[model samples]
Target: MEEEPCSLVYRLEQKYLNDDDAYMDQDIVLTNFTGSSPCKMASKRALELVVLNNANISHLGDVSQVSGLMQHVAEADLAWNSIRWECVKSVLKHLPQLRTLNLSYNPLDGEIAVDLPSAPLLHTLILNGTNLSLTSLSSILKNTPCLQELHLSDNKLDFSDDDESVMNESVKTIHMNRCRIEDWAQVVRLMRRFPNRKTVFLCENPIKSIVHQTPVEDLSTLQSLNLGKVELIFQEFSQKKLIQIYNIIDFLDRSFNDTTLEAQVNH
Candidate 1:
C-alpha cells in the first residue's frame, strides 16, 4: 500500500500561508500521522489557522511537542494513541484557549493526577479506556471545576458506598460502561450525588448485585441504563431474578421520564 501523506503540516502551511481567505474558513483539521517527524511538524504549526483557524487536530504523536500547538487550538482530539499524564500536563500548560479534549483509548496506566495549568475554560473531557483508579479520577476532577461532560468507561474504577465523595455533580454526563463495578450501594450513592446529571452509560456491568443489595425504588435518577450483556455473563441468575432486575430498571426509567416531563412543563 502507498504510504499515507507524511507532510500534512507542511502541506497545510504551504496551502494557506499566504491565503488569508482559506485560513479564515477552516475550523477543524485532522491529520493521521504517527511517529516523530510528522508529530514535530504538526505540533509546530497547530496554532497557525490559514483561514479563520478554529483548529482541531487528531491522531498525531509527539506528546512532548504538543504544548507548542496549545497556543492556537480551540479543541483537540488526541484519542486512540499512547499519551500519558505527563504529556497531558505539558500540553495543558500552554492550551489556554482549549475548550474540549478527547484522550480516549490511550493506554494510560498508573494514577491520573493532572493539575490543569490553564484549562479553566475547558468544558468536555473524554478518558474512556484509560486505566485510572477512583482516587486518581477524583484528583483530576478536583482541578477541572468547569468540566461539563466526562467519559470514564472501560477502566478499573473502585465502587464502594464509603467513597461517595469521588463523583462530582458539576459533571453533566458520565459513561462508565463495562467497568466491572458490582457495588449497588456505591451506584446509589453516585446517583444521589448527581441526581440532575443528564445521562450515565452503565452497560455490561454487574447489575444483579444491585438487584440483590438495594431496593428497586432507590435508583430514581437513572434515565438510560444499559444491561444488555449482564444476563449473558451471569447465567446463574434465574429467570425470575432477571425479571425482577428488569422491573427495577423499568421503574427507574419511568422516574426519569417523569422528571423530564416536569422540566418540560415548567419550561
Candidate 2:
C-alpha cells in the first residue's frame, strides 16, 4: 500500500501491485493495479479489458491525453478511485465496445448523467458507493436499458419519500444493499416500477412496518429477494398486517428457491 512512482497504466502489475505477472495477458483480464500515483497508458493496439483498481484516479489526470488507449475495451474496472462524475462520461466515451464497467467507491454527488445508451453492448454496471439518488439513478438507467445487472450497493439511497420512476427493461438483477431504505411502501413502489425484475438485494436496509396491504401480484415476477436484517415490525401490528407479512415471507422463500433450482439446472 505504498505510493507508486508515476507509471503507465498498462504496467500496473508485476512492475507494481503484487509483483505477480499472472494478469499480464490472460485473455484481457487485468488485476492488482493499486497505487496513489497517476496512470499513463499507451499501447500499439487496443486492449479488451482494463482494470485500474485502487489507483487513486482523480479527474483522470494521468491518462487524459492518451488517445485510444482502450478503444476496444469490453470490461473496465475503475473501482476505489475518487474519480469525478464528469470524468466517467469521458472514460466511457473513449471506449465504444465497453460491456462491463465498475465505478464503485466514487462519491458522484451531483446529477452527472452519462450517455450510456450509446453503448448498446454494455450490460453490467457497478456503481456501488456512488451516492446516486433515486431520481438521478432513474435518468441514468433510462439510457442503459439493455443492462442485465445493476449494482448500487452502499449508495445511501433514501427512498422513504421517493415516488415511483421508470426502469430499464433488460435489468433482471438489482443490488441495493445497505441503502438505508426505511419504508416498505418504497420497496413495493420499486417492485411496481421494475415488473420484469428477477432479483432484488435489499439487505441491511432500515425497512420496517409492512402493515400496508401489498398485493401478491406486485412482486410475482421476483425470483430472488434478499431482505435479511430488515425489521418487519415497529408498533403492534394489526392481524391483517401480520398476514400480509407472512404472505411476503412465504412468497419470497418459495419463489427464490424455485429460481435457484432453475439456475442450477441451467448451469
Model 1 — which ten-residue stretch has the worst lDDT? 258-267
| lDDT (C-alpha, whole model) for all candidates | 0.57, 0.65
Give lDDT tens digits, candidate 2, residues 22-80.
54444343233334321212233445677777766665444443445556678888887
Clashing pairs in 1: 22-51, 23-50, 23-51, 23-52, 24-51, 24-52, 25-52
Residue 259 in model 2: lDDT: 46
The superposed Cα distance between candidate 2 and the true structure at residue 166, in angstroms, equals: 1.2
Q: Show pairs that collide, candidate 2.
A: none
